[model samples]
Target: MDRFESLAERRIREAMERGDFDDLPLAGQPLDFSDVDDPQWWIKRWMEREQIDTAALAPMVIQLRREADGFPDALRRFDREDDVRAYLEDYNHRVKQDRVESRFSRESRIIAPVVDVEVTVVRWRELG
Candidate 1:
């Protein structure tokens, strides 16, 4: 897993938290992407459901490409389930840390639009 996969996992967790799939249409359907594992299908589905902005999600495809490219070669060599599981645990932790650091940096910006708006309002009222 890499940035996009981590982000996608976060998005999925958020969606789950919001009960977005309580009565999911595909709940009982046996859907498998192994035969047709195109990432476009995921994007198309999200677009059709209006879950995310298509334009914003366009960059995620690039992230997915990076993720696919950076997938651990050790996992490919693993023949046992336990080995795969251990590799996934470490990979997941690394991805989680990357996602957290990325989010922290984004949040740390002092000039964020929302923060600027609040500050402007407070200063305006103070000057009045």
Candidate 2:
């Protein structure tokens, strides 16, 4: 797992151990990301709702965004179309597999908290 995934997993384990979402006021509330698709969007919402220091999570958010955008650039750098297609296909397959595992893994429990913190930190880092 990458940094974001590792961090997310850790946060989820911590939350489950505590039985409450740490540092997030909405821990007990139902979460719906249907309208909020972007990591940054969720960060802002969580910050506003939780009234916490958003700066702390800025680096993680930027890192996650960077990773999210990485595959396309990686594929584009390939010299051959076939190579690019192969890379993309492999990437997609890996992503799908990870998604499936994440859905069933305990680490997924922390996805929301990790995302929330990441966005807040990103905003905070930008301001600083």
Candidate 3:
């Protein structure tokens, strides 16, 4: 190992021999995780600890994407097929026409199931 790491390890060993590490919190116990593994696990753990609402701080584009993804589910409030079709067409038109630094493309929107209002809306509701 590197010199710094070797030195730190030696110090820790010395402390352990001196019983300086005994009686510490959660000693000899595996960490208890109430959540799944994630790339931003620290953020999730911190949010759970502090009761933070991460969604409130999410970017508008991210929020918009979530809303768009669940558009069919939200359209469950509508009881008419025409309303569902109209809403889907409007959303598809918006996504197709959006020019956000070229990050979004017509092809991307074109390939997404969320944009296919008729089949998605009907199928999603029927599955419910």
Candidate 4:
């Protein structure tokens, strides 16, 4: 196996020698990376390119944050004020539970704040 090349590697090397990769689009041109200031830029781009949903790949805390952001509009789903309060309370409970459970894991380092149920209830009233 000393001088052997895998089939994929051999095909790639042969293609390179034949200049098959030459004259390709964007060859030798500078990449447009002006928007790479985000630390997770590559991951975000890959997800976009592959048509993957961010929520599918995100952890529970991140999903919760997303849910909280759209929750005000979602409050309309509950016809009664008590239902909204219960939903907000359940959301807060999940957030707190995640915080406690992730205390020592990598996700623990994420600073996800728990949703305030009272403030949300007030918001729900305003929406009403």
**Pairing residues by index, what is the TM-score of model 2?**
0.31
- lDDT (10s digit) by residue, model 2, range 24-99: 7766888786757675887678778889875555543343444445544434445555565555455445555555
Give the residue spans of candidate 1 off by over 4 A: 1-65, 68-74, 107-128
Selected candidate, larger TM-score, 2 vs 4:
4
List TM-score per model, in order.
Answer: 0.27, 0.31, 0.39, 0.54
Tens-place lDDT per residue, model 1, 1-128, is: 35567877988888989998799777888876663577578667767778665545533334433543444442455555555556555544555555555565644322211112233334334443
- Count residue pairs with overlapping backbones in model 1: 0
Against the true structure, candidate 1 reaches a TM-score of 0.27
Instruction: Provide the clash count, candidate 2.
Output: 6
Where model 4 places Cα greater than 4 Å from the true spot, the runs are 1-54
The model with the greatest TM-score is 4
The number of clashing residue pairs in model 4 is: 0
lDDT of 2: 0.53
> Whole-model Cα lDDT per candidate?
0.51, 0.53, 0.68, 0.82
lDDT for each residue of candidate 4 in 2-94, tens digit (9 for 90 to 100)? 378888988898899999999998899999797699998998888888999766678887888788878688898888888888888888888
lDDT of 4 at 112: 58
Q: What is the lDDT of residue 108 in candidate 1?
A: 36
lDDT of 3 by residue, 12-40 (tens): 88899999999998899998675556677
Give residue 34's error in model 1 in angstroms. Answer: 46
